[model samples]
Target: MNTTINMTGNWKPKLMIIGTLLGAGVGLVTASLLARAAEEGGDLELNGGDLLKTALGVVTTMRSVAALGAGIG
Candidate 1:
């Protein structure tokens, strides 16, 4: 008599889902802020006021994503 068994991998689905969620969240926040700033009825000047806030937001997103990737690695 002989017997056979089969197995499937689930790592791809799990990682894909997590990555999608994280990316979407970060992208959403960044896009919304950028759009609002652009629509605030004013000339575009990213070198003065509001620059810090914009920088912080982008840096924060990068840091979080980096941390997550580091942890995964």
Candidate 2:
């Protein structure tokens, strides 16, 4: 009976941690930028169309990133 666990090829958790940190960093930067813009512009108003466009752009970017390395050897 083998009770030992293999530590090799365990990359998913590492990748997830890195991805989470990167996502948090990006969110912080985005929030900071928005705050600065709002402060300088007096008021920040986002219409429905603007929000929809931004959502679509983010989805497209995420899809593109997810497709990376799909065709690589």
lDDT (CA) for every model shown? 0.74, 0.81
Which tens-of-lDDT digit does each residue in 7-38 have in candidate 1?
36786678789878987998799778878888
Q: Model 1, which residues run further than 4 Å from truth?
A: 1-9, 45-73
- Runs off by more than 4 Å, candidate 2: 1-8
- Each candidate: how many clashes? 0, 0
Estimate the TM-score of every prediction: 0.44, 0.77
Task: Quote the RMSD, in angstroms, for model 2.
Answer: 8.2
Inter-residue clash pairs, candidate 2: none
Candidate 2's TM-score: 0.77
RMSD of candidates 1 onward, in order: 10.1, 8.2
How close to the true structure is residue 55 of candidate 1, measured as C-alpha lDDT? 78
Which candidate number would show the highest lDDT if scored against the true structure? 2
